[model samples]
Target: MAMRRTRILFMGLALLVLACGSTSGGGDDAMASGGSPGKALYNMNCTLCHGRDGKAGLNGAKDLTTSTLTKSEMVAIVQNGKGAMAAYKQLLTPKEIEAVVDHVRTLGRKK
Candidate 1:
């Protein structure tokens, strides 16, 4: 009986180790289907002014949901600050900027 219990415990531990080592996918595995890669980045950086839905409009922040700016236009503004907004050029990479733009563009149509 003691040996059987030990074997069962060993098996459980083995399975747990295997599960821990396994993955469903690579980077961004938890991201939803069709979800933008920039969503997380936006949450970390832009959420303060833009909010989760991009409608916060706090502290001179524009309502991104109603924004009609082109992608290039938005990128330029993000890179170079506008009014109360701080320039992200010294902070985020160009790729990060593009990702943020992609995420922000989806805000208006989310509802």
Candidate 2:
């Protein structure tokens, strides 16, 4: 009986480890879906000003959900800084900036 209980305990622990390993905080899913990295980056950097859905407009930040800017235009503004917004050029890599831009585009589609 003692050995059987120990085996069961080990099996339960192993199952828990497997479950944890297969789960993520969503960052991996976002990347796997081709936009999660951008979403993660946006949440980290833009959510405060743009709001979670990009319509917050705090501190004079634009309502990205309604903006009609193209990807290139958005990238330029993000890289160069616009009005009250600080430039990300000194802070983020080009790829990261692009990811952020991609994330912003999703905001416009959220309704």
Candidate 3:
């Protein structure tokens, strides 16, 4: 029992260390240099389901390239929740949401 307890304690300590040591996806300087905070946050939290390119098709994740919703509508959808999409009012700030809206708007601009 003592050995088991020691193992568990060690595991917990290791996990805590790793969590603290892990850096955000990019460097802090990068974020400060006009990096899109919304894009970074979205990439970290939403990309898996929404797709890295914003066209994941996961459970019909809407293609931002074709979304007709205005910025206000997008903000509403992000903050108030829409269909399967979760509300991010608490998770993201208005500034971050604007950044995300901007990034989403560029999905298919070249094509």
Candidate 4:
């Protein structure tokens, strides 16, 4: 039974490592971190320039309020980047990019 127990322990440790490795991908981080996917991602990545409330307006960061870009357009801009904006395609997954787009939509809301 000693060998059997060792094998089981090894398998459990392997599974634990695998789970921990994949957890950093943001699937669970999104839920546990609080805030929506976009809000979390934006806070981590975009808030420096765009501002926390989305209106600090640093370095000519275009007021998201005035942006004419639709959600899809905004996603493209984020993925591809504009004049001064750097593209985030490499830093974030497509799902994370979509989360940012959805979060931007909520800017300027009353609540």
Residue-pair clash count for candidate 2 = 1
Backbone clashes in model 3: 0
Best by TM-score: 2
Give every collision pair in model 2.
30-36
* CA lDDT scores, all candidates in order: 0.73, 0.74, 0.62, 0.69
- In candidate 2, position 87 carries an lDDT of 79
Each candidate's number of clashing pairs is: 0, 1, 0, 1
Candidate achieving higher TM-score, 2 or 3 = 2
TM-score of each: 0.68, 0.69, 0.63, 0.64
Model 1 segments beyond 4 Å from truth? 1-33
Q: Stretches of candidate 4 above 4 Å error?
A: 1-34
- Of candidate 4, the 10-residue stretch with the lowest lDDT total is 26-35
Candidate 2's C-alpha lDDT?
Answer: 0.74
Runs in model 2 deviating more than 4 A are 1-35
For 1-111, candidate 3 gives per-residue lDDT tens digits of 995565356445544533443544445426333555555555554665577677776876787767788878987887777787766666566776777677666664644
lDDT of candidate 1 over 1-111, digit per residue (tens): 995565356445544533443433334424533545566557666777889889998888999999989999999998997998877776667887898798888888744
User: Over the full model, what C-alpha lDDT does candidate 4 score relative to the true structure?
Assistant: 0.69
Clash pairs (backbone) in predicted model 3: none
Question: What TM-score number comes out for model 2?
Answer: 0.69
- Rank ordering of all candidates by lDDT, starting from the highest: 2, 1, 4, 3
